[model samples]
Target: MIVLGVNLKKIFNNHFQKYIFLYFLVIVFLMIGISTGAITIRTVDDTAREQIINYLGSFSSIISKDADLNTIKVFRYSITNNIQTIIAIWLLGITVIGVPIVLIIIALRGFIIGFTVAFFIKEFKIKGLTLSLLYLLPQNVFLIFGFIVTSVISILFSISILKNRINVIRRPSFLNRFVNYTITMFIISIIIIIGSLVESFTTPIFLKVINNYLTVFMK
Candidate 1:
């Protein structure tokens, strides 16, 4: 019994370490994409810059006016979009090709975030930085956490599937494991949804406050 306990402890430790390593690996990939995105934003041609700014301005205008009404629309849109991505990651885990796809999705998410922050900072300087931190970071921090956790689990499951195919790991209650995975994913989905709600409902209020501050400061 003591030997069995020791063996289990070792296995748990190994798995924990692997999960940590994978988490950081994913973060590194995300950072690479983020840096690239920031650089791209900084170097884009004037026409492209104008287009991007105009697009962002339109979104801001919508949010600035009738924030309460737009909050519902934003919540619906954000949650739907997030759910689709989560579903894709879950579905893709069943296939061998999903590993790379998951990585790409994570990196793309990071790139979008980096580009947005860069754009704001470039255009508005300190005010942009403040907005990015207040308006963007609050919800995104949770969303990123969800994405990283989901991606790690999805990749691990995919690897498990591959190992099962090759008989590298003994098959024991695969169905049970899968059911647990599904439940876990559902819980993580809820977390992401909460983040969306924060972004949709809470962020606009922050934006309004910031806008008011800027107005007074400029005056």
Candidate 2:
């Protein structure tokens, strides 16, 4: 019994180490994507620049205004988007081809964030940086964290399934694990919803305050 316990402990430790390594590897990929995005922003052509600026401008206009937003609507949208991504990851993990797809999703997330930040910094200079930090970073931080966690869990489960196919371990019951994964995703989605509320309600107020400060300071 003691020996069996020791073996299980060793297996858990090994898996934990692998998870850590995979997490950091994903982080590196994300950072690389971010750097690439920043470089892309710097090297785009005149027409491309115009389009990018216009695209970012639409988002900027939202927070720059002093009007009230439909908070419930924003919350619903945020929750829906988050839950969709989570479900996609969960479903993909059941397939052998999902590993690359999951990685691509992670990279795409990083790229969008990186590009937005770079665009802001390039267009508004220091003020753009301030705006990105204040208006963009808060909600994205939560979303990104949730993405990483869900992706890691998906990849781990996928790998485990592969191992079971090769007879490395007996096939374990999946229902309980799936339920736990679903519950975890629900909790993470809630965190994301809170972030959406902040973005919709608190972020505009923050941007307004910062804009006023910058205006007075410049004067």
Candidate 3:
């Protein structure tokens, strides 16, 4: 356990700079997309808020107005399948094309968060802030850290491998590049799983708070 802790601390210390930069990039992209979306929405209608609420209603309807347990089971399976499909694609690139693939995955993840947050904020006004804080803020904290670490480790492995700094791949060594990537991905996967569980449990509570508080305030 002590050895594991020491290794983890070393890994985190090594990647700290990259992690900070990645977070800043994510925040900047989020702000830009949100500002653009807000400007676009302003040009459409003065009753932009009503339109947003309508859209939210529609979206929520799709989620809640479902069938029984069997339908929910299928829906859950579909979601799992989609996530698995994405992971498989990324893995394919990791093994074939190498480290650039991980960087691409990081960029794509950031873009999705930025776009989604921007969309919600434009549509729901202040409620978007509440909902996002309740939903995304916690999960994103975990995700960004996990992704940045994974990305850094991938890059490090690739660079060392390419430069022949790490001949352990062809020879017997304590830390092979492929083994490092696998371990890094495994750790990141756990963070993602925990984040998902937190989101699943916490979001509904936050949503209820918004429903109750905002419903009274808007009246």
Candidate 4:
């Protein structure tokens, strides 16, 4: 376990520059998400909150309180999106034109997350905020980590393309390169899985209490 930690640390450290880019990117996305959410809440007011509560109540009714089905779905979707985004970014970075595509992809992801969370909060009010935490935080941890890795690779590839130095970024060891990519992806997958577990086993219960309290206060 210690060895694995060290290896991951080394990989991250070696690509510190890319990590910096990823940090800025996440921050920008988060800001956009929060602002959009606030605007949405202001526009809709209380009715939106009731709608969100109704939606959650319906969703809870359909699935088991444990959240197993939802957790699995979230895990599968997040991993697929993370891997696909990274691969797309890598392939696009091969040409100068792909740089903007890479940033666009990242930005779009941020926008979606922001919009979704904001919509929920606006629709559900205080309860929506609590529920959003249960859903967003864990999965986000994984997404951000995966984004850092992919963003770093994209940066390296983009820089090489700009300098017309493809050879500097290319390695002949295809098997080794593939292994490294797999390891990084697996790390992301693990994080998502853990998040799903939290969402499934714990978050529902947490949200239940918030809903109960709000129900009483609203009376």
Pick by lDDT: which candidate is best? 1
Q: Write one digit per residue (lDDT tens) for candidate 4, span 1-219.
A: 999999989986766754676557645655665466556555665776677557656544444464465446644664565556666766775566786666666666666666667765654677668676775676566665566456555655556556644565553454565466556555555554554555555445555554564455446
Estimated TM-score per prediction? 0.82, 0.76, 0.60, 0.60
Cα lDDT tens digits for candidate 3, 1-219: 999999988977766755676545544544554455445554656576666556545534444464342334543553464346336533643443565455555655666666556656664678777677777788667656655555555555555555554464565442565676766677666775655555555555554554554455456
| Model 1: CA > 4 A from native | 1-18, 60-68, 206-219
Q: List the residue pairs that clash in candidate 3.
A: none
How many backbone overlaps does candidate 1 show?
A: 0
What is the C-alpha lDDT profile of model 2 across 120-211, one tens digit per residue?
68767897798788778888777777787678778877787787778845767677766776676666566666667666665546545555
lDDT of each: 0.81, 0.73, 0.57, 0.60
Query: In terms of lDDT, which candidate is stronger, 2 or 3?
Result: 2
Q: Output candidate 1 Cα RMSD.
A: 5.2
By lDDT, the candidates rank as: 1, 2, 4, 3
In candidate 3, how many clashes are counted? 0
Instruction: Judge candidate 3 at residue 139 and give its lDDT.
Output: 64
**Count of clashes, each model:** 0, 0, 0, 2
